[model samples]
Target: MNIIEDLRSRGLINQMTDDEGLEQHLNKEQVALYCGFDPTADSLHIGHLLPILMLKRFQEAGHRPIALVGGGTGLIGDPSGRSEERQLNEESVVQGWVSNIEDQLSKFIDFTDDDKGAKVVNNYDWLSQMSVIDLLRDVGKYFSVNYMLAKDSVESRIENGISYTEFTYMLLQSLDFLRLNQKENVTLQIGGSDQWGNITAGLELIRRTSQEGEDIKAYGLTVPLITKADGSKFGKTAGGAIWLDEKKTSPYEFYQFWVNADDRDVLKFLKSFTFLPLEEIEELKKEVEERPEQRTAQRRLAEEMTKMVHGEEALNQAKRITHALFKGDVKQLTKDEVEVGFKDVPTYKLEESEKGLVDLLVEASISSSKRQAREDIQNGAIYINDERQQDLKYVINADDQIDEAFTIIRRGKKKYFLIRHM
Candidate 1:
């Protein structure tokens, strides 16, 4: 299938300006397109995956992709989906975030200095030097206050009150588009559905700024905001946003997050996120109905996404922990894998080595008292390292450790506690 048809099949295209023109333009030539990411945080999360993958899709279709980091505009936050004004970060802080985001972005898009290769541009390069007069003369000339106020982003914030700083964000982003179109010959801008107004504003700037007879017909496209069928937002867990940085969120947790995708949402996620063929996605959809218990679709999505983001080694490690946990055998997991697997489980520190299991339980408050601890042990309710602890006087020693670092203690089918040999 063609590029547009492929996108349509996967439901990636939410809103595209001049669909016919874009289709023809994409078919006729390798159009240069750009997408901007604001540095709101030091690391990009799973919520940011759509656009990154979209860029890859475009690049694979033989188009030049430009990943623009909003270092300049990030200094002033975008109010695209916010009710209140954001607290401004220091210039240094934002710069650090910009660097970190740039690094994270590199993992998604291949950057090349060649003509067809992807380009990474920072809006801060030129935006930081422009004065207020430059903004008025160049950008403000095109955007009327009425047009800005009518936008969904601004209109929503008007009641609660948005700052003049944030109110001018569309113009800033539009300027980024217009400038990129002029310098890099980028004719298309893409972002999330929330950025439709800002994108169209950029197209308007391109239209007004171009001289007569100049072929500066720019276009904008957006992807729908991902929503869960269960009425929750995607990329969120109890721990918070699922970050791309393994340090912030371990590979195992990231793998588990995708592995547990809602049955209703998994097919859509597979279509939109994976580079897997349509036939394969359809087959997975069938499996979701035929054998939902297998979670075949969820497994594919997890493998593809985990390997794509965290790489092959991390993906294997995540799978090892997952399989080990399922089989109730975690002895094979390394120290690092143990940390990632049990990071969120309840943990207790033992001051002394080779302590009695009863004493350890009472000291860690896993049981209310020594009497309860013995009762739990003798009653076969407690387990150490997945083996039932029937002896009340069983000792938790260095030998009980998984990697000489920690021991897994289980009270029942659902409860787990990690005791460290500190």
Candidate 2:
């Protein structure tokens, strides 16, 4: 399929300046396109996934991608999604973020030096050198106050207040487009829906900067914001943003997040997030309708995303933890797997001893009293290391420990606690 059609199937295209023209331009030649990311944080989160994947889609379609890091624009924040002004970051801090974000961006695209391979560039190279006089005379002259005020990014912020620094972010972004067009031969800009104004501003800069009647055609496209069916934001869980960096969000945690995808949303995410073949995804969709109890879609989504982000070994570990927990075979887990599998479960550290399960249950508050603990054990409702403990005086022996450091306690069907041997 054509790149636009493919993006449309993935629900990636939000707005494009001219669909037919851009498609014609794309099919005619391998043109250069760009997407700009600001160094707002040290790592890009799952919310940043669409754009990164979109760039990859273009490169695979035989186009060149220029991943623009806004090292310069990051200092003056864009007020697209915010209700209030952003506290500007110090240059030194933003520079660190730039380094981190650059490294993260490098992983997703083809960056090998070759024809049509991706290129990473910093706007800081040009934006830091331009003076106030030139910025005003060249870029500021093209944008009118009325036009800037009408943009959704500025219109929403005008009531609360907007700083001149942020107000001129359009001009600064426009200048980046102009510079890229001049230097890199970049002819198109892509971004989130909120950046429609800025992307158009860049196209306008290219238009006005060139002499009249000069051929300086450029284009802009944007992707819609990801949203959940129940009106919550996407890529958010009780924990927080799902980051691309495994250190911030472990591979196990990331895998579990997708494994818990809502029945309503899993199929949509499989298409939008994975490059799985359409036929394969459609087959998985049939499984969702036929036997959702199996959660086939959720499993595939989790496996695809976890493998994509964390590699095969980490994905295997996550699956091993999951399978062990499901099969009531906690003894199969290693120390690291136990740590990740039960990271959010209640934890109580204990001095190593052969503590009887009944007394330990009462002491750890797993049972309300000794009578309750004995009743729970006798009723076979308590589990030590996932093995049923019907004996009233089962002891926590070294054999009960998974990997000699931790014990798993499961009460009834779902409640779990991890006891660490200190």
* Number of the top lDDT candidate: 1
- Residue 6 lDDT in candidate 2: 86
lDDT of 2 by residue, 347-376 (tens): 988795789888889878888999999888
**How large is the C-alpha RMSD of every model relative to the true structure?**
1.0, 1.8
Q: What is the lDDT of residue 15 in candidate 1?
A: 97
Over 4 Å off in model 1, which ranges? Answer: none
Candidate 2: regions farther than 4 A off: 114-116
| Stretch of 10 with least lDDT, candidate 1 | 108-117
Instruction: Write the residue-wise lDDT of candidate 1 on 1-422 in tens digits.
Output: 77889999999999999899999999999889999998888899988999999999999999999999988999998999889998888888888998898898889888987866798889999999999999999899888899999999999999989999999999999999989898888999999999999999999999988899977669999998899999977899878999999999988999999999999999999988999999999999999999999999999999999999999999999999999899988888888888898888889988788899888899888888999999999899898888898897688888898888989988978788998888
What lDDT does the true structure give each of the candidates?
A: 0.91, 0.89
